[model samples]
Target: MKERKIALSQEDFAKINKAVQQAAAKGSKDSLILYRDLALVTSITNRTVITAIDGNNMAEHVFTNIDSAVIVK
Candidate 1:
């Protein structure tokens, strides 16, 4: 028997697709990618990375903590 690992799901793909679509429509159609750092994540969100998580790299993002909510950039 073999174990299969799933990478991106439908919802996660939607979130990423939405960003790209929104960017294209708004003329901000630069290269958009999702990166995740499990270390900083603590938990997880629909914001999954397009790449595999290797301990060699730390995810890049700007976070704002406001009123118990976290905002990602």
Candidate 2:
């Protein structure tokens, strides 16, 4: 597979970090689902976003292998 890059602002980065921390605290493991303006599928163990999808295309996709979800607006 081709390597994917997801650009995020400093504020978005901070928010994702915070959300990951909170999810970990709540006993989450493995993958983490984060929703900012777009949807992000992250690996908690790897500490990286595996993929991202814009909100407009979110409805047509199905997310799997996620242990928890965080919404940041």
Candidate 3:
């Protein structure tokens, strides 16, 4: 997948989303946002996100889900 979605507050998400939009629009900077979910038993990073950006190839993100459900296909 070229994006990740995690369980976060709407406001927090908005902030992150705004940054991405800005970067994408500005075409000056790029962003790679990583998100994760706590394990039911253990509280740890359960996911990973890897985003790649460039002049032409922008808005390409990746989501390596540790829980498999955070980023649905």
Candidate 4:
């Protein structure tokens, strides 16, 4: 499969980073929902976002393999 890149502004990236940090503090090792529309499946143990989804594309989609969620707004 082709690799898809998600672009974020510096501020948006910072938001995501901060959210990730907070989730880590809570010992969250699951997918996180950011900005209501975006879903970030992260590995708290690895401190990385494995995958992401935008709101427009989240319609008719089911999020599985996730244990947690965080709203950035």
Candidate 5:
């Protein structure tokens, strides 16, 4: 697991929770969530974040095994 250095506000957690719920409703097992400049991989069933990546390291990153993607603006 990678170190989590992102500073997430309460509102950010709310948004992410909402997005995860929506994905779960759609039967998504794993999801990729994009919020601001951060990207996170989450397990909908477990309600856990698998990994988080910042914008600085996102350019060459490739996501796999995700059944859905949610972009939170």
Candidate 6:
């Protein structure tokens, strides 16, 4: 098996957190957060990321079980 790793700065994490908060405010239980080249599947109610997909893998990729989506600039 191969393992993939990602490094995020505090500021980047803060941004993602803010997005999650916004989703929660909108009554989203699950969300797809688009940040830069990463697509994160998050659980709004749980306040945690369920999965992440990079831009390279996003082509023709299908995301399931998400109730909302947020694009972060």
TM-scores for the candidates: 0.38, 0.75, 0.32, 0.77, 0.93, 0.92
lDDT of 2 by residue, 1-73 (tens): 1333456778877888887777777777655455565777777766777777776667878888888888766
Off by over 4 Å in 3: 1-7, 32-73
CA lDDT of each candidate?
A: 0.35, 0.71, 0.34, 0.73, 0.92, 0.89
Off by over 4 Å in 4: 1-5
- TM-score, candidate 4, is 0.77
Model 6, residue pairs in steric clash? none
On a 0 to 100 scale, what is the lDDT of residue 68 in model 2?
A: 81
Residue 15 in candidate 3, Cα distance off native in Å: 0.7
Q: Where does candidate 1 stray beyond 4 Å?
A: 1-6, 34-56, 59-73
Q: Candidate 4's C-alpha lDDT?
A: 0.73
For all the candidates, what are their Cα RMSDs to the real structure?
Answer: 10.8, 2.8, 15.1, 2.5, 1.6, 2.2
lDDT of 1 by residue, 10-69 (tens): 875565556545444554323333333221221122333323332344346443321122
Top-lDDT structure, candidate number: 5
Q: How close to the true structure is residue 52 of candidate 6, measured as C-alpha lDDT? A: 83
Ranking by TM-score: 5, 6, 4, 2, 1, 3
lDDT of 3 by residue, 1-73 (tens): 2233334578755654554444445442323443332111111232122332332333353333322222111
Ranking of predictions according to lDDT = 5, 6, 4, 2, 1, 3
Clashing pairs in 3: 2-61
| Each candidate's clash count | 0, 0, 1, 0, 0, 0
lDDT of 5 by residue, 1-73 (tens): 2375688889999999999999999999999999899998999999999999999889989999999999998
Error of 5 at 9 (Å): 0.7
Error of 5 at 40 (Å): 0.5
Worst-scoring 10-residue span by lDDT in model 2:
1-10
